[model samples]
Target: MNFEYSDRSKALQEKLTAFMQEHIYPLERAYDDFVHANEWQVFPELERLKQLAKDAGLWNLFLPEEYGEFSEGLTNLEYAPLAAIMGKVYWASQVFNCSAPDTGNMEVLAKYGTPEQQDKWLKPLMNGEIRSGFMMTEPEVASSDATNIATSIVRDGDEYVINGRKWWTTGAMNPNTKVFIVMGKTDPNAARHVQQSMIIVPADAEGLKILRPLRVFGTHESPEGHAEIELDNVRVPASNLLVGEGAGFKIAQGRLGPGRIHHCMRLIGAAERALEMMCKRVTQRSTFGKDLSQYSSIRQEIAKSRCEIEQARLLTLAAADKIDRFGIKEAKDLIAMIKIVVPQMACTVVDRAIQIHGGLGVCQDTPLAMFWIYGRSIRIADGPDEVHMYQLGRNTIKSFN
Candidate 1:
C-alpha cells in the first residue's frame, strides 16, 4: 500500500515542522525551570503559543471528518504524521489543541452530544477557550475492563445524579477544565456492554470534588495534572446524557480507536527524539580512551534503536491508514497491534538513551528521564499491553475459525 504523505499532508508537515522550531522549542528551557520549582504556574507563554499555532493554520488537526463542525476536517491517515511531529515535545499538542483526553472528549461531543451540548461544550473546546477531562477509571475496579466502571449515573426526574470515586481523571488539575465526560452505570441489569452511559458534568457541579492530582513516577504534572476525584451525587441535566442511556460503551469504542492511534504516533515521535539524543550524546562523549560512538556495543544499540523506531513508525502509519480506509471496527487488530508495540518500543529506545547519558539521563539535565517514565506509563494507560494482545490473539483465531 502507498505510504507517501499526500500533497496536503506534505505542505502542512513543512509548516508544522517550521512552527515547532520557531515557536515551541524556545519554551523548552522555560518549561524545565518551572518544573524544577515544583509547581506548574500557568505558563504565560502558553496563550501566545496557542495563538501562533492557530494563526499558522495548524490548530485542531486531530478533528477527523466525522467531526467537521469542530474542524475543517482531516482524516486519521493525514493527521498521523503531524501528530508524530507534535509528539516530539511532550507539551506541543496543546499548542495546536490536539492533546488528549480533550481530543477524545471533543469527538464524543461532536458525534453524540445534543445541539445545545455541542454549542456549550464542543465549541469552547474547539475554540481552545477551555479544557476537559474524562472520568472513567475507578480505584475500586479493574478499569482496564471498562464494564467494571462502577460510578452510578442514576436518573432523577429532570437530571442524572452521578455517584462514585474516579482516579486518573486527566486534565482535572487545569483550572480551565470546565467540563467532564463521565462514564457510569445507568442500568446495571442491561446486557453487560450496554449497562453504562456517559454524561457531561460541569467541573464545578455540586457534590463533585477533586480529591488530588495523581502523580506519575513522582511528579504531579501540575496545571494539567491527572486527578483523583469523588462525585458524590453530582448532578447535571438529563439532556447532558450523550446519545441515550446505555451507550457509553459504544461511544468509548468510537472514541478510543482514534485516541490509541494518536498515542502510538506520538510515542513514535518520542522514540525518534530519544534516538537523536542518544546518537548526539555518544559521538561527543569519550569513555575508556575512546569515543562512546566508536564502541561496537554502542553502535549495535544505535542500529537496533534505529530499526525499531522505523518499524514502529510504519506500523503506526499503517494503522492510521487502515482506520481511514476501513472503519474503526475493521481496523481493530492494527490499532491494538500498534498500541501494544509503540510504547514498548519507545520505552526501550528511551532506556538505552538514558544509559548512554549516564547519571545525567536519570536527572533533570535532560528529558530522557521524563521520556522514559512516560513511555513506561503508556504501557499501562489506555489499555495495558496484555489486554490489547489478548484481543489481537482472539481476533486472529476467530478469523481463522
Candidate 2:
C-alpha cells in the first residue's frame, strides 16, 4: 500500500523537472513552429537537445532494470514520475530517448531477438541512431481485438513475405524510422492467438510503401506522424522473426503493459500542466468586472480538475508498482484499470482547462488544445477504453465469485 516514491526516484524527478524547465519549456514555441512548417523533418534543435539530455545522464529512462544492460536500472514504479515530467511537453520523451514504438520495439529485441537480430536492430535503436515502428493494427479489421489482424506473412525459401495494410503506425512517417516490428498471421489455422507472429522488416524493403500520413484532430503530428502503410510482398530474412512462430500475442502483451503505464502517466502530466495553465489564466483576466478566478463555476471546475488529476496519478502509480513487484500478467487488472481511467480523466480535465481559456485554448497559442487531442486520442489507442472495460469487468466478476 506504500505509494511513496523511493529516494532514487525522487532524485531523478527533481533532475528531470529541472532539465525540462531549463531546456524543454523554453523551446516549446520554436519546436512547435518548426515541426508544423517542415512536415516530416526533425526539429533543427532536436539533436542538440538530445545530446544535452544524454550528457545529463537522462537518456533511456523508460527501460526497466530487467532489460539488463539497456536499462537505466529504474523499475516501473521508479520511472513513473520521470515519465510524468517528460509528459508535460509532448515531444520531451524523445530528447531523452524514451519515446514509444522505439521503447516497445527495443524491449522486444532485448527480450526475444536472436543475437544477430539484436546486433542489427536493437543496438541502433538503443543508441538512438535510428527510429522504428510497430505495425499491428490493421485498417480493415476490428484491431482492438488484435487476434482479428489479417496481415499475412508467408514463408518463401530463405525469407518471409509480408502482405498487409496497417494504419496508425505511429512512427512510420519519420525519415529516421529504419525498421518495423510487424505482426502478421503465419499459420492461420493455428489456435486463435497462436496464428500470429512478429517479424522485423526494414523501412526500405521492397514492396513497403508509405501510403499516407494520418492526422489526429487535423494535425499531422509532425516529424513522427501516424501513417497508413502498404506492405506487399515485403521480404526479410527468416532470422528477423522474433522468438518463434505463435509468439506475437505474447510479445504484444508484454510490450503494451508498460507502454500503457507510460501513456497514462504522461497523460497525468499533461492534465497537470493544463490545470496549472487554467489557474494562471483565470487570475490574469477579468470578465463582467470580476476576476474569472473569483467565479463559483470556474473555482468548481478547477477543484474538480485537481481532484481528478490526483486520482488518476495515484491509480497509474499503483499499476506501475504492481508491475514492478509482480509482472505484467499479474498486473493485468490494474493495468486495465489505469488504462480505462487515466485518459478519460485527462480528457475531462483538459477540456475544462480549454473552456477556461476560451479562444486561446482552441488555438496553438497554448498547448491545451494539443493536450486535449492527445487525451481524446489515447481513449482509442492501445486497446480502447471499452475493450479494457470489458476485460476488467470479466476479471472482476470472476474474482468476486
Best by TM-score: 2
Candidate 2: where are CA atoms >4 Å away?
none
Residues 1-401 of candidate 1: C-alpha lDDT, one tens digit per residue: 57888899999989999999998888876876675575646677888899988899999999787665676578888899998899888878999999998999988898888899999999999999999999999999999999999999999999999999999988998888999999999999999999999999999999999998889998877778899999998979999999999999999999999898888888888889989999999989998999999999999999999999999989888888888888899889999999889999999999999999999889977877777777888899898999999999999999999
Q: Give the TM-score of candidate 2.
A: 0.99
Instruction: Give the number of the best model, judged by lDDT.
Output: 2
Q: What does candidate 2's lDDT look like per residue over 91-151, in tens digits?
A: 8999999999899999999889889999999998988889999999999999999999999
The C-alpha lDDT values of all candidates are 0.90, 0.93
User: Each model's TM-score, in the order given?
Assistant: 0.98, 0.99
User: Candidate 1: how large is its RMSD?
Assistant: 1.1
Model 2 per-residue lDDT at 225: 95
Poorly placed runs, candidate 1 (over 4 Å): 36-40
RMSD of each: 1.1, 0.8
